[model samples]
Target chain A: MESILRTENLCKYFGGLKAVQDVSINVSKGIIQGIIGPNGAGKTTLFNVLTGTYNSTKGKVYFKDRNITNFKPEKVTKLGISRTFQNIKLFKNMSVLDNVKIGFHTQTKTKMLDAIFHTKTYKNDDRICEERGQELIERVGLSDLKEEFASNLAYGNQRKLEIARALAVNPDILLVDEPTAGMNHIETRNVVELLEKLNSEGLTVIIIEHDMSVIMNLCHSILVLNHGQKISEGSPEQVRRDENVIEAYLGREE
Target chain B: MMDQVFSLIQKLRAKSVYFLVLIGIFVLIFPQLTDNQYILHISIRILIYMLLASSLNMIVGYTGQYNIGQAGFYAIGAYTAAIIATRAGYSFLLILPLCGIMAASMSAFLGFPTLRLRGIFFAFTTLGFSEVVRLTILNWRTLTRGTFGIPGIPLPEIVNFQISTNNHFYYLGLFLLVVMLFISHRLINSRIGRAWVAIREDENAAKAMGVETFKYKMINLMYGTFWAGIAGGFFAYFAGYISADSFILDESFAILAMVLVGGKGTLVGPIVGAIILTILPELVREIARYRLVIFGIAILVMVHYRPQGIAGAKAEGRRIDVEKEYEAGISENAVETTAPGN
Candidate 1:
């Protein structure tokens, strides 16, 4: 399979501290890869660098063969990369549907004048977008709450809604940061299943998750990070039994 | 059964069309009820303020930028119109656009840097700016005539016609208000409107959504201030006088209060607010000073009870029609998949 994203020694720093230092991992096309590490292992920071949420301190990031080391977040999104924040960032006061609609704004090309007049073209495109938004909402099983305030959604549904929102951008690769952070086991299982389903559709997914079971079960390949550096990379079974991985998780062994 | 009842309810609601028609007829016949030029003047003032409040609401309400220097733009407009008509001896038609440009340019200049600050900080900065503009007008005695103000400002003379009386200006004001209201309605329903709402709801998210946050914000400020300037010019010409005291912080606060009390983001809310508040003191002319006290009390009570105001809370709330359209689409599939036979 072709590599969809490649990072070469991607580094990010905070003053004297290196949050992500001399770390690199390749994500192949249509694979669900997981970056697993304990708290402060820089999994989220690495994800940020990939999605252009933060500019890299050094090194290069290539998305679909194009080196995009320091593009802004929206520019990165327009280039077919999207992400969901660890803490939910939905437009809270807006309806769930509107929150989803905003993601599709990148795909829309209607002129301002068309929107002003509610012209035939504008109305037609708007109707199509509305339909597409509704479809995505249904696929995530939150169509029933489309008109509910985003702030009012159940925690699990909100996470699912975030995925649906990311998908609305029609991205080639999705960088999800801790989708199951606050979810219960059953919700976590639901999310794993959803990610698997999305991956089956040929959508490339890279997840940063702390849950060992979720990482081992859903991800085809696992990359382990310790102190902002990659320590191990291989299949789930290979990395799971690695000595460095064990040392990273346990800090010290008997 | 529910659908049937809902359709029937919709039919009953349609009866409001006839009620609105009756009101339209009454409004047409209203001025004939009293030939009092004072009443005509009051009506025209209310209409002008309604237009101003609605325009100002676009910036403060939809874009989530609090501008307490709205009166500064108003002053810019009034002075531009006054100077052009009086000193340069320009035609009324020519001076209006010049006034708009002057106000818009000043608004963009102020909005560019200060928009970097958020919430209360932005509000206070604008308040300070209004004070600066007022002091400039006051101390620039040679240009603005200081507190002496401008006098004998010519009434707008059209082709072979002069709007020299309250009635003539009433028609002129009415025409402008209608044109402004139409433009506002179009603007708030457009892509720029969505950009404003997005910024208001979440500035970071708006930028992340590829919205040019600063550029759109400047545009919002420019549009709002441009209209306000024109309305201020209308006020100067109508009153046949211009002064710094008339366009003060109190007036800015009054307009802000109007938008808030009427529901900030709702299209008709500010108009309703301005009309009621502008005409309110006339009924209490006996205790005119108490008018401010009463207005203050009313605003406090309204905020405490209904912060959402008369029309709606946020822009999304007022857009029930769009939400319902989206909801309908969502419901069809959800109901279909969840239920085999519906």
Candidate 2:
């Protein structure tokens, strides 16, 4: 499979400690890939590095043939890479629809004066944004909660809204961290289904998940990390049975 | 159904327009009702403060930036205008906007380089910025005439008519306050406004969602400081004297107190705050030094009673935020089991 997002020898060090080291990952287009590891295995750190929250110590990242190493997080997002935090990062005070609209921020073309004057172009853009926000909310099945405060949504719905927000970016790749961290079984299933839905709709997803069931059920490929190092990378079935993945990740806690 | 909704919105718009017109008429007639110069004078001061507090609202209230250095911009505007108008014999009309741009540009110049400071760090830096501007004016003997300041600052003129009365200044204050309100109101309800709120609520999330948080924040600072500078220009002419002594850090606190007492993040909060705080001291003038004590207590009570200010949206107290939910769990997984396994 052709890689849509590739990271080579990425390293992130905090003083003496290496949070993410010598990690190379290639997420293919239109595939739901999962990054898993034991706690402190650097799954979230890897995701952060991929999304440009923290600069990689010594490595390169290429997204869609563009070298995007150490771009600012906003630049990364504007370049069609959007992410959700491990614990939901919804604009809690903003309405659900507004939350989704914020994801469309880079796509907006209205100038400061247009906003100040409510010019014809501004009105048109505002309407278009509202319609697009509504469409995403509907796609996520949060149509009924469109106007509600993001913080007020149920845990499951918040996860769905986070994905919907990421979708609003119209990203070429979606990096979701711990989407089902605090979710129940049904919520997890919903999230799994939502990731599938997004993948089916032609989005590439790179997810950090502690839920083994989510990884096995949803990911086409899995990369297992142990203490900031890539221990295994293969199809879900292969990684599930891989001796290294099991010993370092799956069997470590068993 | 769409037609009904459109017409309902139309009715609401028309009603608000009428309400605004009525308020405008009342404001215009207020001087006629009370020929007392003291009252008109205070009203003018309140209007100028309203502009300052409302402009400050663009940062503190809406943007959620803890910028207590409005006096820095205010001083810059005043000094730039005072220095030029005194040296070049420029009209107040030309000088007002120049002052605004000067402060706005200064704020942008300062804010851009130090955009990395988050929350309170930025606030302290801004506080320091005010001190720097003040010290420069105090220490610069050639340009600013040191502590003596520029006296006999010219009054504004219209069609060669020198507007030397409190009543005329009232209109200028009203005009600028409306401008501040209109611009801020327009921006806050639009994408720029939404982006600001998003940044305020969660900057990382806003950035991750593609909002250039720094750029928007600088714009907010520029817009706010622009008005503060303009208000400073008004203060220069209004007081008929320009002095660094008046542009103290205490003025910054006073503006902040207005925005907070009125409410942070609300359209009407600063106006309400500006009015109440501006008038509160005048009303308590009978008690002399006790007025400060009373004013301080009022601020204390207001802050204690309603941290959200009077017209603020959302719960003003500490929100049960998602910071923990977003990044807290990452470190906790340090010693736990391996990545989940089926």
Candidate 3:
């Protein structure tokens, strides 16, 4: 299968700190891929670099066979790649549905003049976006609370809403940063199931998760990082037994 | 006939259209109710400032861009219309849109590079722009006449009707206010409107969602300053004078204060702020210079207690909690604005 995303020799540095050095990843289409590393391993820096939040010192990022390296975040999104922040960056004061509707922003085609005239085109697009937002809210099990503010949601629901928002962009590849990071066990399980459902429906999901069990069971292939370098990339079982992966997670034995 | 009248009143209760029509009729006949030209003059000024404040709201309230140089744009519109009207001898209708375009161009020039700066930096840049505008007008003696000010601006004429009397200006102001309200109401519930709120809520998230923050900011500035220009043209003709003194940095803050006090992001906020702030000092004119002191106190009180804006708090009771919002990782001031588009 063709790779949905590819990075070659991706290097990011903060002064002398090699945040992410020589990290190459090829995420095949329609798979749940995970990036696992201990603290200071640069998983987030890598995600930021990939999503165009940070400039890479040296590397090329390919999305669906297009050179997308260092493209602005909005441009990167326009090219069919969407991402959610690990820190949950939903429009807090907006309603739950509006958060998801914002995801459909780039895909909609209502101009300012159309809006000013209250044109039929604007109305039609608005209705469709609302309906799609409703459907996504239902899919994420936020149907009953669609009218609530995003910030009013509980921790787990907020994470789920973030995912729902990311999914709203209608991306071929979804870059999720720590979706299950602060979620409870049950919430984590639901998220794992949600990712599986999304993947089964032809969405390629790349996750940066610290929750090891969620990664192990959910990701088809896992890439392990240590000191900003890729230590291992293989099937879940293979990554689990790898000595380098074990050392990266639990630290080197004396 | 009594029964029919009763039924008509009953129908008005169920349908807001009837209520609106009744208000429209009342407004049309309001001059008869208050024949005092002084009162009409104040009312016209209030109506003008309402338009100005609402225009500024498009940027400060809705787009979350701190623009403190609204008066500079307003001055541009005012001087542009006055100059064109004096030099070309045209109707205010033609001058109005010309002024808007002039202000919008200036706004675009300033906003294009400066909109990229975040928060206070952007505010100060606009502050500097406002100073630059005021000083240029002050020093350009041949064009603006400096402190002497431009006097004897001709009142606009529509066909045979001259908009010279207080009543004429009142009716004209009301007509323009209606036009502005219609435009803003329609625009606020549109795709571009949503993009603005998204940018205000979080620029990065908006960008990730494919909302070009810079483009939306420019549009926001253009829309905002466009109306300021229109109001400026109206003021130039209404006051029959144009001067740099009225377009000072203080005027910018006053308009911003109008948005903040009335409510930052709501449609109703600007009108409320304009009415309250414009009329407050006048009402307290019994104290003369102390009115400014009282006005300062009133604004301080309003901000201290109602930073969410008068309308935002009253409309939804969703006042912001800075610490809670910080913990949630989103600007709490987002609550200070309404997503009417949503």
Write down the TM-score of every candidate: 0.84, 0.91, 0.91
- Model 1 segments more than 4 A misplaced: A15-17, A65-67, A119-121, A181-190, B1-29, B157-164, B290-299, B313-342
B160-257, model 3: which lDDT tens digit per residue? 77888899888888898888888878877777887888888888899999888899899989999999999899999999988899998778888887
lDDT per residue, candidate 1, B111-181, as tens digits?
88888888999899889988888999999998889999888899898886988877788778878877777
Ranking by lDDT: 3, 2, 1
lDDT of 2 at A143: 98
Model 2, docking class: medium
**Positional deviation of residue A160's Cα in model 2 after best superposition, in angstroms:** 1.8
Residue ranges of candidate 3 with Cα displaced over 4 Å: B1-28, B286-296, B313-321, B324-342
Query: Which parts of model 2 have CA positions greater than 4 angstroms off?
Result: A249-254, B1-25, B286-296, B322-342
The per-residue C-alpha lDDT of model 1 at residue A200 equals 98
Measured with C-alpha atoms, the lDDT of residue B258 in candidate 1 is: 85
DockQ of the candidate models in sequence: 0.15, 0.50, 0.38
Report the C-alpha lDDT of model 3 over A8-76, residue by residue, as the tens digit: 999987766677899999999989999987765777778888989889999899998889999999988
Worst 10 residues of 2 chain B by lDDT: B333-342
Candidate 1 chain B: 10-residue stretch with minimal lDDT: B333-342
The number of the candidate with the highest DockQ is 2
lDDT of 2 by residue, B1-342 (tens): 634743564465468778668887999788778889999999998998898998898998777889999998999988887788778988777899998999999999889877678888999999999999999999999999989989978777866988888888888788888887888888887888999999888888898988888999999899999999999888888887888898888888888888887888888789878898888777767774464465577678766655666555554354335355535555545432342322
lDDT of candidate model 1 versus the reference: 0.80
DockQ-sorted candidate list, best first: 2, 3, 1
Query: lDDT at A95 for candidate 3?
Result: 83
TM-score of chain A of 3: 0.97
